[model samples]
Target: MEIVQVLHMNGGSGDTSYATNSILQKQVITKAKPVVIGSISDLYTTNPSPCLRVADLGCSSGPNTLLVITEIIEAIDEICHQLNHNTPEFQVFLNDLPSNDFNAIFKTLPAFYEQLRKEKGEKFGPCSIMGIPGSFYERLFPTATIDFLHSSYSLQWLSQVPPMVEINKGNIYLARMSPPSVLQAYTDQFRKDFSLFLRLRSNEITPTGRMVLTLLGKKSEGPFGKECYFWELLSKSLNDLVSEGLIEEAKVDSFNLPFYMPSRKEVEAIVCGEGSFYLDGLEIFDINWDGSDDDDNKKFKFDRFISGQKVAKLIRAVTEPLIAYHFGDAVIDVLFNRYMEYVSDHLSKEEGKFVNFVISLKRK
Candidate 1:
């Protein structure tokens, strides 16, 4: 698949839109707040300036994109206050693929700036927010232009579907049923994409600049862990549609997700091997599938708030566009409805967990 053209979160603020259903991604940004603050803090420690250059890679359009920008600026403001330094004018770049809903982001900027001026005073003179549309796997800015770089919940997406995936049939992602070769293909793709990412960022960032990245990752060596079941059930749901003759089996055979959740070891090896940056800090944590809405007090219980429908909607919001692009719109609702039932049934058996990796890095 050509991921740059096909991959984007469901757009606009509707029930099934990514803007409305990205609570989980928002929580991820929150979880990475400390790393982000530290990166900014370390950035200004050596290169204190009246102007700052920052970029948020894979910044899909929505409130979350702006929220991340606002938080970074706030962190910088607080750090400058603590260091007795002057607050810097900001030049922020919001980047994603060309097809991303940048218009949505632009529409919110006037109000965002107005709110910023009201809070930070008119003396917060010159802050420029520019939208840059491109894949982060390559260079997007001039050399040594960026002071800080941040990407959250986006790196896990491979630049494209693995080349060998045609040999692995009937699975949408790397799952328990996928053969060893399929897993190896995914691992290889991630290694290549991530290495390129580091190389590009190393070029764009100043010597003292730092970056914080939060993405889905695995603790175990095996691909099939807690979150694999989500895909397993989703695959089952799609198979059910095929069984009903709602869609062709060939369509399913050709479909595969351009995503990979790397293990901590795998991540460490790639970053170390890339030789562009050194890992400043690394952390791995677990979050519930439904944005950590699990009520441990009622583990055996099930409710609408933590229902399969919610999880299915979240997945649909992020994935429907891609699936529809390949499978046609007629089956979109039916596919997700079946997925909801499967998710509900599976969640009833066990609470779903997603492992996330948050790493802080500095350019060499």
Candidate 2:
């Protein structure tokens, strides 16, 4: 539950004016439709009166959470309309770690509420929104009360210290590549975190509730998940620095990521381990793959490979904490700037990397 909350050049947060809401809106709305429907299908029936409670676990501050809540509600509204029933009065609970900035989220609520009220959506009902901040690895809401749960780019976070990481030794949390010791520790942490998640939710989710999750996962045999390439590179780079006495080994050893990425098998096992949920449907797809042309066939002419500074900002926002934790805080910016250069160089030689994953689990 304890995580090092450090910030550097990073993307936006709801709390910060980074416009994460826009990024989240773009990222989640498109990919979440299927899972949203799947979750709704589990609990919705052809009844005139609709009663549903949905939770967005690890819902970060600002626009992303609010946008996702809307997308999910709209999906449910479609289902309700298809069955030809009055829309339900929905209660949406957005939860995250206490460290997350809820004040910003609350500040945006009136606008979000007003926006929803003004828009004539397919799902037209008074939505009750509340902020519940806490750890998802532990207890969440009341027993047998939740109808749907959704977590995105979250769950991959490990629950505790990775077992194989020895603080005493110089290795710290850097996953070993050949033997996969660090990876094993990370996997174990995920297993523990996920088990706790399911157990906690088992008490809260109704008999036929559904949960949809998306996390960065790996298809590579590499030590880090494909989604975590930057982190892996950063870790190894620091270790290299330690080997050369350019940086302190002690500093490198002191660092670890509270978050991680999981494999499809790893995720499936977590849901199955609970025994209360079934994998009704699943999907794995690439996101942000820099195609020769964008989805709308809009060609971005970046003389550099990464296209724009926005991509740079995103990686910086997400990786600065990890970078600063290992290397001196002094070099965090330099490290990512170097990484961006490499990204440009590499993309010129080859296409940029792709992120893949599975989204699953439908309760019976």
Candidate 3:
């Protein structure tokens, strides 16, 4: 699959759109808020700029996109307010692949600006928001231009599907039963992709600039731990459809998502190997698959339909395009419907969780 062309969150604000189904991502942003604030605080303290250049890399279109930018701006404003300095002008760039829905983000800008004006009054410094369509794995900005860079729940996506995926003919991603070779292929791809990401950003960011990244990750040493089961379950749902002749088995074989959940060790190793950035901070948070909304309910009657539907919507928002391209749009709904059922059944038995990694880095 051509990831650049086909891989994108469901566009526009509809029921199945990523805009509506991104609570999990929002939770990730919330979890990383402290790190984001700290990074922004340090950015201004060490290298104060009257006009700060910020880029939200892999910033898919949605409310969360603006939420990130707003948080950064607010943090800067708070810092300047405490330090008795004037607020800085912001040149904010929203970045994602060319296929992302830039129009959706544009439509919401009016409301965003209105909100900012109301909150900050006349003290709100000049802020410019524009969309830049490109992959962060490559050079997206000119040398030493960006002041601070942020990406959330995005770097987990590999630039492209691994070339040696033929080793795991029956599966879509790394599964518990997947051989060591399959895991190695994913590890190698992530190392290559992340090393390139650091090198590119190292060139674009000022020597004192900072970057904060929040990505889906694994807590255990192996890949077959938390946050990795969702794909495994998704593959099972597709296998069921293949048995029922709803989709061809060969189609499933030919499909693999351009995604990987790296362990914290792997992230640190790559950062060191690249030798372009200093790892300032690294943290791993355990997030429930449903963003921890259902954690308090244990004795309550489990509503299979609602729980299944919720998880299904979240998964579909992110993976619909990829699945539809391979299985045809006709089976899209049917496939997700079955996936919901499977997810509901699994959640009923045990709590589902994702290991999320939030890292803070500085250009060398």
RMSD of each: 1.8, 4.0, 1.6
Q: Which ten residues in a row have the lowest lDDT in candidate 2?
A: 7-16
Q: Compared to the true structure, candidate 2 yields what TM-score? A: 0.82
Give the deviation of candidate 2 from the true structure as CA RMSD: 4.0
How much lDDT does candidate 3 score?
Answer: 0.88
TM-score of each candidate structure, all chains considered together: 0.96, 0.82, 0.96
**lDDT per residue as tens, model 2, 209-279:** 77877776666645554455545545655566677666777776766766666667777777787777787
What is the full ranking by lDDT, best candidate first? 3, 1, 2
- Please report, as a residue range, the 10-residue window in candidate 1 with the lowest summed lDDT: 296-305
Off by over 4 Å in 1: 294-306
lDDT (CA) per prediction: 0.86, 0.63, 0.88
Look at candidate 3 and give me any clashing residue pairs.
Answer: none
Give per-residue CA lDDT, model 3, range 1-364, as digits (tens): 6789998999999999999999889988988999999999988988888999999998998879888888888899998899899999999999999999999999998888888889988777988899999888888899999999999989999999877735575689988777788788888999999999999999999888999999988878866885677888889989998999888888888777789998889999999999989999999887767664554555576676676787899999999999888888999888888889889888888878888889999888
Error of 2 at 185 (Å): 1.3
